[model samples]
Target chain A: MDNLNIGRHISGQFNEDLENVINHVMHMGGLVEKQLSDSLKAVYENDKELAQKVLASDYKINNLEVSIDDECTRIIAKRQPAAGDLRLIMAVIKTIADLERIGDEAEKIAQVALESFDSKQQDLLMNLDNLGRAVLQLLQQTLDAFTRMDVDAAIELHKADKNIDRNYDALMRQLMTYMMEDPRSIPSVMSVIWSARAIERIGDRCQNVCEYIIYFVKGKVVRHTSPDDM
Target chain B: MDNLNIGRHISGQFNEDLENVINHVMHMGGLVEKQLSDSLKAVYENDKELAQKVLASDYKINNLEVSIDDECTRIIAKRQPAAGDLRLIMAVIKTIADLERIGDEAEKIAQVALESFDSKQQDLLMNLDNLGRAVLQLLQQTLDAFTRMDVDAAIELHKADKNIDRNYDALMRQLMTYMMEDPRSIPSVMSVIWSARAIERIGDRCQNVCEYIIYFVKGKVVRHTSPDDM
Candidate 1:
């Protein structure tokens, strides 16, 4: 919020309104980050209770998205902000949608923990733990970049998403090999594959948030210009 | 666009600006729909050339999304639309992002066509064709509802997303059986699995567009209230 630096308007209410929306967005980001981290922990430690916590807590993120969306609409209607203030509001709206989906993907990841894996398949989850932790770090850094509105940090972390994808691809190959070796293991291994996919998607969402960070700060749509270059 | 029934302001330019944005959104929606349809066709006919066309033409949708997004930002800044007009702008902004992702998913589905399928696996692609066509119909209906801003159609089509999910789940179980029965077919079957996942995601994105339609018309966030219920 401090980084926004757009609160020196003649109208005091307008300044407070903008500040509140930004603060609420940060609060929502914190909750989403927590949900993602807890879901990974649930998968890593095989804690059904923690997995249940991840499931039960998702409503919090969904509710925050709705209320914040309402606040954005109200701000635009009441304040009619222009330029940087407008961009920030736009970015907040887009970011919350991505954040909400990230929470959902985390929930998908947590579901894997509820399905019991055999001792051998436990090692597969261990590999998934590695990929999950990598995605978690990407989310953390992306959140920090978003908080500070740091374009350089956003670009740097955007590159880090490639690492997460590489890890996910490697893990997927390993799982396929395991499934082929023992067709009986396909059911359980399939869950691990799906979790890996979820973790990879979380990385993609982080990459999207990073683009929004750059867009808000630089007023440039940096989506296709990334190393993905698409 | 006509169903919006706004844009009768004292400022003549405001009316034109609002109309232009809506028209561009519909145009973009058309391009996205074609991409989804062509991708499915490429898969069904096993036409790599058509699949390649789907891939190459994706940039049109991406570029339209960015341009239309800029138009929304410009309209908001210049016209300061409130109430329904404001909701329409917000809907356009959100709908374009979902539309772009749908393009990406369609591109993913089309990628499956580039790889050759065996005679046995060709039957699986036929099943995928059925699911893909069903999802294509959902997209068409969702786009129609969005253009008209019809709340009832949006709700009805939102329910239709459940049917898409049901088809996807059934197709997935069948694919898993195919893979289990013949483990060596994992690599090719894996592509179909990913393609199926992409098709299902397009349905989810259509469902999202439907919610946006309802949000624009009713000025309510109808996400968590769906039968999927978040």
Candidate 2:
């Protein structure tokens, strides 16, 4: 019943390689999780140094993505895995891509965080911080579901993404109203909107990873399907 | 030298299947191109009908993406392709993903177009229209480069993405100024900004497609590389 047991029936080396790739993916996921957290902290605390660190660490995430992709390519060429194994590799490839993009979004938030605002917008930052915490939780749970190959957990995580979208829409309306009230705060408010967008996108990416987990577990293509049906 | 000649040296059925997938991809690309153009027209003319059509047609694009992905999976499983053949399938998979996301961006723009503006923002729409045209051109050329497997053409298309970024930044500044000048216009301007962001993302997706072309042709990892080095 465990989908994570993929490649167990295959050659020993193939199983080992698959395990290595999964470990690497988990490592990359951990790095991405930290990047998101650091980026949010940078924005909330207005810490330029932390933001700079996020920017610098982005290259490491990028390198990991390329290496993981290369490993997957090598496995496909060498093993010619079919069915479940093939699906796993495809899912990993897709997951790493989403992870790398999440890293990019984090970097964008960091860049915005590094920019100077005329005054600290405490309430706006508080709201963004709450949203960031929610997204981070979704991401962490998605990764756990991936590790456990838990379809139910994956589906639950996928549904959680709707909440992130709703929060994003509400935040956008509030930011727009703030900008309208005081045009002087327009630039700063714009930065917050952009950062929130990056975080919102991370939530979407987490949903994608969850889809992959479900696909790997159930051998079903649940993407683009209505949540009601799910 | 012709990279489009991929899978030519393989089995006849494999070659035929590859051709069919490529044709489907090209067909999908054409549909996406139309979607972008129609969404732009809807915005420029404030035509809700045109925007509605774009939204309605998005499902077709999504279907194509799913079918193409299924075909790729089938090809990999049946053919057990190696080397260049494997790379070709990988590139095709990556390209279709970017193509689907481009469709999503177009849909976002269409959704924005469906929202009613108090008065037509002529100057702003005109600028957006121009930028949209430029992005459309880049997308068309990128698809052409894919069809031809022209590395030089792909490289050229990659360089063109920079212009889209510059245009997006300039347009953001203009939108911000307009919002500052008239607080009442903030909501409409926000929609425009979101739409413009979608267009800008299309440019990024085109760049990704170009990178895939380059990877398939030259076996190079051109992604995340600096333009100066490219």
* lDDT tens digits by residue: candidate 1, A3-116: 678667889998888788878888988998898889889988899999999999999999999999999999999989899889999999999999999999989999998999
- Model 2: runs farther than 4 Å from truth? A118-120, B118-120
Give the poorly placed runs of model 1, Cα more than 4 Å off. Answer: A228-230, B228-230
True contacts kept of 1: 0.55
DockQ, candidate 2, comes to: 0.81
lDDT by residue (tens digit), candidate 2, B1-230? 26767466647898888889889999999999999999998988889999999999998988998899989998999998887778889999999999999999999888877777665477888898889999999999999999887889989889989999999999999999999999889988888899999999999999999999989988878888998888
Which residue pairs in candidate 2 collide? none
| lDDT per residue (tens digit) for residues B1-230 in model 1 | 55688656788788888878878888988998899889989988899999999999998998898888888988888888899889989989999999999999999999999998889999999999999999989888888888788888888888988888999999999999998999999888999999999999999999889888888888888887856552
Query: Which 10 residues in a row give candidate 2 chain A its minimum summed lDDT?
Result: A1-10
Question: What is the TM-score of candidate 2?
Answer: 0.97
Judged by DockQ cut-offs, the docking class of candidate 1 is medium
